[model samples]
Target: MPITTNGIHHEERGSGDRTIVLLPGFGCSIACWAEIAPLLDGYRTILMDLPGHAGSVGAHADGDLPTLAETVYDACREIGLTRFIVAGLSLGGAISMRIALDHPDEVEAVLGIMPWNAGGTSAGDPVIEGFNAAYGDIETITAGITSISNDPTKTTDLLHTMPTVTEKMWRGWLGGGAFTSMADKLPGLRVPAFYLVGGKDFVVNQAKQIDDVRSIPGGRLVLHADLGHLACYEEPELVAREMLNFLDTHAIAPA
Candidate 1:
């Protein structure tokens, strides 16, 4: 087991020299990468539990993206990760970019899977409205999950892990991640960036995501035409394949 810093718990896996820190989406745990982690065989993967999520402590009442980003960066630093790529899904994706933006010299690259930035999904968005409406109701959450995912077992696992989240952490993440935007900062990003978008994702605007990613000088976008918001969970092998290919093409080896 690895140490927990600032209430953020993370553990390392794989023995490869290259390292990539993995962050899960809001309301999710490191378990989000259960299927994907094994596929990343040639890299040291750091699976992290964000504040207020599973295996972590509560979050600040006004925990915004920058604050969250700093907390994550500090935690990684505590673990002796001086230089590495940062990758995340949804909320995690946004934080990964923030890490790159705030600490340019430390981050090798950034990988975002449906990042909730660049005027993507926000507090008043219909998708977020639905999430708000279904927050505490298991039935509504299950229905929402069913609507988005084609796999039942993964859905079950997701729901099984949902109860570990408290109301404060949920709202804190919404205020910090779901309601924030990084549109103004992306064009100035100094590191290599890769964004993966699911065409059928109801939670994020695919067109806006494409445009936002394109705005970055070195950003690359990949569209999964048939996948939805939980693309990684639904097709881990495909996502891992793309991620590895991007890293190799960019020669983002460990420093």
Candidate 2:
């Protein structure tokens, strides 16, 4: 793992010409995708830590969604990444879509795992609102994490990362347009997109997410009736298999 001069920490893993950039959810680091990355042995994976998280050093509260998106994009460019598949979870999911929408030529495809926009563009998702309401409350975040996660060990790991979260980042999520709607833009999306959400998700509205994906051109949705918000961590095998299937269907073969 290496931290760039700009303070964006990233690591390249696996092998192949085609690359898949993996972005972690809010308050998560590259370790969030540790298990799933290896499963995608056919493609190289670039794991990144967003500003104000883990090894990265920056103030997220100072920027909005586009700003953060550009931060990630610039970091990728610094790493010499050109065209690649951008994939992420929760907050990361929304950023990935934004990146795809803004740079269709560079982002070959996008995969959003329970993206933030899935909860509708209105006031805010109940889950996200609750987080905002209980900003910096450990018990609240812990309870929320426990409720959405299926694996005990994964839950523990997530809890351990909580201390690194800054109040400014939390505020950024509120005022920085982290939950802003991209509904109008999805209809004009140029690249292929696939969205995966758990039917029992308490964080993002699954039905709304389905409709969101449908709006995109050649968009596909995968529903896991039994999974929750952290489906990838709970069941890495199932998630990876579905992801690989999507890639295969689209003829995105390993380089």
Candidate 3:
């Protein structure tokens, strides 16, 4: 059953004492977890729709990233998620960083997947450009499709998601200081964190992500070979496997 807490819509699945919260990237719906949810075995999974996206569209706000994370924490508390792991992609990743940083005791681990700094308004901003292209109009949207993936078959799935996106979602990501700028706080994240990136993610600087994670104490970084920004979307099987591996090492306390 779907539940709402603090205006955030989320659903839980799987079965285990430990929980894993899955957060989608920018402009994505809660369905973003469709590919990976079933694969996460032995843990209760919370599939959440970020504020201002999909079912939670009404929850859009002008607050900064930490504020958003606080709202997420409120939802977790309401749902009885006292202790859990967080896995996020892109914009979700930045929010996850804030959550873990603020509540290291409650967040057992953090799985940051292709999470980049969601702050900037430069004309050359690839992320903003991609969004504008996808939602701006017909010609740009068509041109933006192939930029996400090389596979023709996979392109169709991403294309279908464009309509669900909104102007609020755009502001939350591209607007200045929408997120608390995870880039500088990388080294301060005390929770066990796993940073996953792809070789082909053009929007985010992959090298910087790797360097940021390494600077954190015992932070682990993995690069998905031949993949792009949406690794969770493009390679769910590998993402699930890698996520489980990270959970085993960090989330599950050693006996």
TM-score of 2: 0.92
TM-score per model over all chains? 0.92, 0.92, 0.88
Predicted candidate 2 versus true structure: per-residue lDDT over 29-138, tens digit per residue = 77778899999968999999877778774534343677778888888898999989999988889889989989988998899887776334456557667766766678
lDDT of each: 0.79, 0.79, 0.73
Q: Which ten residues in a row have the lowest lDDT in candidate 2?
A: 55-64
Checking candidate 2 for backbone clashes, the offending pairs are: none
Candidate 3 lDDT tens digits, 47-93: 98777677666675443577667777788888888788888987788
State the lDDT of candidate 1 residue by residue for 105-205, as single tens digits.
Answer: 98989999877766646447766767666768998877777776767667566686565666776666654456667788889999999998887877777
- Tell me how far the alpha carbon of residue 21 in candidate 2 is from the true structure, in angstroms, after superposition: 0.4
